[model samples]
Target: MESDLPIRKIIHVDMDAYYASVAQLDDPSLVGKPIAVGGGGTRGVISAASYEARTFGVRSAMSGALAKKLCPELIFVRTNFERYQELSEKIRAIFFEYTDLVEPLSLDEAYLDVTVNKKGNPSASMIAAEIREKIKARTGLNASAGISINKFIAKVASDINKPNGQKTVAPEDVLPFLETLDIKKFYGVGKVMKEKMYRHGIYTGADLKKKSVAFLQEHFGKSGAYYYDIVRGIHHSQVKPERTRKSLAAERTFSENISSEIFMLERLENIALEVERRLKKSKVAGRTITLKIKYRDFTLQTRSKTLPLYISSKELIMENVKDLLYQDEMRDSVRLLGISMSNLNNENPKKTKDISEKIIDVQLKLDF
Candidate 1:
C-alpha cells in the first residue's frame, strides 16, 4: 500500500548477470573464465556466460555453433530456472523487510516504493546501501541500486555504478543529467524519434530541452506532454505495484540454428533493425535486452544485458548485444537469431530553456 505522503521514494535494484553469475559463483573454477549456460549444437543456444566468456564473445541467443566459433573453449551449462525463481523469491522477501511497495520486473530486477517503510529509515540512500550489502551477503550476488526522488532518476542512478554498485540522483541534478544524456538514452525517446530529434537538432538531452512544448507535442503527439513533464522532472504516474505491462514478447524460432558467419550477421542486423523500429513507435526505453538462440541439437541459451540507461538506438542496442553474442566459443552451426530490449527509459522528458536574452534596446538613446 502507498503511503499517504507528499513524496514517494522509489529505488530500482538489479542483479548482475543473475543466472550466469549464479552458476559461476556455485563453481569457483568457472570464475574468470568464459562459460555459457547452454548451447552445444545446431538446436542449442547460450543461456549465460561467465564474465571471462563475455570477453571472448560468447553470449546468449547466438547459435551454439556461432558461440563455438568465437570461443573454442567455451563451456555450456543448462539453466535451472526453478532454482533462479527460488532465489528471486528469497530476494523479494528481503525487499519486503523494508517496504511492501515492491514491484518486480523479472526475477532479477525490481522497484521499491519506500516512501514509508517498516524499517522507518529516513534516508533512501542509506536504505539503498544497506539493501545492497544485505543482498550480497544473503545471495552471494552483486546488485546495483538507484536512489532518487522518483522512479526515473532512481533507475538511472542505479546504472551509474554497476556490479554491486549504487548511485543517487538529487532533484537539482536530474534535469541537467537528462539534458546531457544521449537522445536514444531518454526514457521516451528511441531510434525513429531520435531521427526526428536529430532533424530537429536534438541530439543530446540539452538539445531536447530546446524544443518547445508545442513543437514536441506536434512531433510526438500525446507523448510530447510526457516528454515535457519528464524534462522538467515531473511524473504523475505512481510506483504502480500492479501496473499492467504494456508489452510482452517471445523468441523467434528459426528454420534452422545453423551458424554461418555471413548469414548470422545479416540475420542479426535485420533482427536488431526490426526491434529498433518497434521501440521507436512506443516512445519506450527498456533497461534489459535479452538474446535467445536455438541450435540444431535443440539446445537453448539465453543471455541478457540490463542497461544503466534506458536505450533505443540500433548502435547502442547492437553493441552490447554483439558483445553478448561473440562471448561464446563456436560449438556448432547456428540457425536462429533473436533480440529484445526492456527497462524502458525512466527519466523525465527534458525541455531546454534558453536563457539567451533577446536584446531590444528601446532606451539606447540614453547612451547616445
Candidate 2:
C-alpha cells in the first residue's frame, strides 16, 4: 500500500566507538592500539571496545576475563562519563545549528528531522555531510550519518557506511532500499526475533512485504502490524526533543557471587545509597521500587512493590527493598543486584498526533 503521508527528511547521526575513541583522543599513545573501556577487574564487563580490539573479537558487555583471552594485548580503561557528557553536549550543539528537531537516542547517536532547517537547506544529504564535517572539525572525532525519508530508514542507512562515512537513501529509493535490506538489519529485530522471522520464510524486507497485515498480526501480535507498515515505508514516529525519563536505576556486578543474605544486605546498602544520590540529583521521587536479581547462571528476575507515597531517601527506599529482598527465598548464587524506581513524580503524560495525514513528497534533488 502506497502511503499518503507527507515525506520527511531525517538524518541519524552516530558516533564511531565513542568511549574508546575518547580514550584514544585524550592519550596519543593509546591510538592504533587495542583498548577496552570498563573491563579491568575479574568481574568487570566491557563498556566499549576500540575497533582494534573488536578486530580481535572483543565487544561491549563481554566479561573482562574473556576479553583478555580474546586479545592478550587488550588494554582496559575506566569509564569517564563526565568527559563523555562534556563531549556529547558539544556534538549536540552542532546539531541545533541546523534544526531543533533533534532527538537524542543516547550520548553517541541521535535522529535529526531536517525537513525545515535553520539554514533553509533543501537537501538533507548535504545537511548530513555538513554536520558530520563540523563534528569532526570541532571534536576531533569521527561520526557517521544516514539520510532518508523517515527515522527508521535513516537509522538503518547510518550504519551502511560507518567509521567516518555516510549513506543517503533518497525519497525515490526508500522502498527499494528497504526491500533489499536483510531482515536482521531492521531496527528492533534481534537474534530471537530474526530466527522467528526466518522460520516463517521472512529473511529480507521483500519477504516481509509479501506477508499481509493480518498474517503478520496473527503470528507476531502487535509487532506484526508494525513490521507490515514499516516495510511499506509508513513509519510516522517523529523526532521528539524532550524525551521524558521514565525511570532511574543503579546496579553493580560482583567479582564473585554471594549466596548469603548478610553479604547481600551489605551490598544493597551501597546500591541504595547510589540510587538515592541519583534520585536527589534528578529531583524526583518514585512510588514503585524494583529489585533486580541476576543469578550466577545468567538468569534474571525482578521483584517490585508500589508504595502508597513517593519516596526518594535512601532510608525510605531501603525499607521497601529489604522487604522485597527477603520476600522470596534465595534461588541461586547472585552475581548482580540492582534497585530502580519508576512512576516518577516528575513524569509528564505525552500524546502523539499522527503527522502522516497530509500528502506531500520530499525534495528529490541535492542542491549542495
Candidate 3:
C-alpha cells in the first residue's frame, strides 16, 4: 500500500498551550506562573492549563475544583476566545504564504501539505521551522512541528518534541520509527483500545505488525484494518484544504444527569441559541436541524428533520428540535444534549443527496 501511493510531505504544527499561553502573553504579571483559562467554580471545567499547572496533574477538561485541588496556587483566568481567534487567523495567514493546503484541526493545531508549495520549498521541515518562527514572532507564542510522509505519522511525530520544539521523521526512517512506538501513542487508540490490545499481547507497533490482516479484522472489526496499515507506516490520507463548514453544532454535558422534561427543554433552548449564533457568525443557514442526546449509560440517539426552506433563526431551530424531543419516548436519564444545523446552501445537490442517505453511518463520539 505504501508503494502504490505517492509520497507526500506533510507537517503538523501545534501551538504550545494555546489558550494558556495567550493569557500569559497578554498579561505580563501572569508569566512563569501556573494559570488556568476557565471558570474557577465547582461546575466549571478548565479550557486550558499552563505548562506549569500541568506539572501538578492539572489538565484541560478537568473540573476547576479538582484542578485547584491538584495545584493550590493555580490562578484561573477567564477564556478570551475572540483574542484566540485573532491569533489563530494570524497563524493561518503565515501558513498560507508557504502552502494553500492547510487543514486546521482546531484553533491550536493544523496539518499542512507542502509537497508543491507556493514558495517552491522542497523541504517540509524547513517550511515547518519557518512557520513556527513566524508564529512566535507574530503572536509571542511558541509552536511545535512534526514533518513526515503522511498526516498520521506527522501528527504523531509532532508530540515527540513539544513546547517550542520540532521533530522530523525521514521517509527512510518511517518504518523503524513506527516499529518501536508504544501502542498507547498511536492515534485513535484510546484507553479502552489500549487495554484490549495489551490483553491480546500487542503493546507496540512491532507487535501489532506481527498479526495477519485477517486476524486483525476478525478482532477489531472495521478499525482493525486501519491498525494493520498504520503499523507498517502506510497511511495514505492527504491534507484537505480548508472548506466551508458542512454543519454548525454546539453541545453541553450536564454537571448532573436529569430526567425532567422541563429541564431538558431549557437546555435545548440554550443549545439552539448557541447554534444560531454560530450560523450567523459564519453567514450561513441550513434546511436540516439535528438533535443529539446521550443517556447516562452512554447509549446515544439522534433525531433530524429537514425544513422546506433554509432557516438560521434561534426560534425556528428550537421549534424543530422541540418537536423531535417530544416525538420520542423518554428513554433514560439524559447526560448530554446537542443541536446542529446542516444542508447549508445545498450548492451540490448530488453530494447533498448522497450525504442525506448515508448520514446515519456518521458516528458522533463524545470527547468527555
lDDT per residue (tens digit) for residues 1-368 in model 2: 37766678899999999999999999989999999999888899999999999999999989999999999999999899889999999999999999888899999999988887889889888999999999999999999999988899899999999889999988778789989999999998999999999999999999999999999999999999899999988898888876777899999999899999899989999999999998997788999999999999999999999999999999998899999999999899999999999999877756454232221455435431
Every model: Cα RMSD to truth: 16.2, 3.0, 7.4
RMSD of 2: 3.0
Report lDDT (CA) for all predictions.
0.72, 0.91, 0.86
Query: What does the lDDT read for residue 82 in candidate 2?
Result: 83
Q: Name the 10 consecutive residues with the lowest summed lDDT in model 1.
A: 359-368
lDDT of 3 by residue, 48-89 (tens): 999999999999889899999989999999889889999999
TM-score-better candidate, 1 vs 2: 2
Comparison by TM-score, 2 against 3, better one: 2
The TM-scores, one per candidate, come to 0.62, 0.90, 0.85
Clash pairs for candidate 2: none
Candidates, ranked, TM-score: 2, 3, 1
In candidate 1, what are the lDDT values of residues 1-368, reduced to their tens digit?
A: 11222445678998887888888778888776777887765657777776677787777778788888889888787777768887898888889898777778888989887666678676777888888888889988888998876677677677778767888776556777777778777755766888887887778877777889899999889988777767666764556554444432334445565577667766777787777876875567677888777676757677887877777777887787787787686567665567877665634445333211111211111100
- Which residue window of length 10 is worst by lDDT in model 3? 351-360
